[model samples]
Target: MSASAGSPGGAARSLRSLRDLYDQAVELPAEERERFVAALESAGSSHCAQLRRLLAAADPSAESPLDDDPWARVEEEEGPEPVPERIGPYRILSE
Candidate 1:
């Protein structure tokens, strides 16, 4: 059955379509991506701006959240922990 625009199924389909568009756009060379986005805009696709932003964020040269270790700063601020003197039956020696 076909989903109406306001239905949950319709929303899912729209999300799927956007994901598919993103996948396709991401695979294109950087130089060609602008043209692809422009084409979508010219076609009056509501997702064009969102797709452009997604493409920009996915660009290889763009800084990625994964590039930095989030915990690194916390670790630096906390510094290294001191070794415990003893544990249960064994005495702690070297770190």
Candidate 2:
């Protein structure tokens, strides 16, 4: 897409505008961030697509890396689940 495909500004101008916009947003209090973003969207924010994705990624509630982790993410992604547990009357209790 052009720097400012939908607006009168050129691509380079749009990049600079978005850079400044993000910088401003990051400077606001965290509590006010959502309101700031909402105000932008209500005013037909042009950078909604990028803002939405960045916000999702920045959400603290989102999943995070674990400490003392031994396995790789690829390992979990590629590994198969354990087999279903089975029970019988004679099942041994010893560990």
In TM-score terms, candidate 1 sits at 0.62
Q: Which stretches of candidate 2 lie over 4 Å from their true place?
A: 1-9, 58-62, 65-95
TM-score between model 2 and native: 0.51
State the lDDT of candidate 2 residue by residue for 1-95, as single tens digits. 65445576686677776777777777787788778788888999797667656666666677766533656665678796544444565554543
lDDT of 1 at 24: 89
For model 2 the local lDDT of residue 80 reads: 63
**Residue 42 C-alpha lDDT in model 2:** 91
lDDT, each prediction: 0.88, 0.69
Candidate 1: C-alpha lDDT: 0.88
lDDT of 1 by residue, 40-94 (tens): 8899887898898888787779987799998898889998778888888899998
What lDDT does candidate 2 reach at residue 89?
56
Candidate 2 colliding pairs: 3-11
Question: How do the predictions measure up, each by TM-score?
Answer: 0.62, 0.51
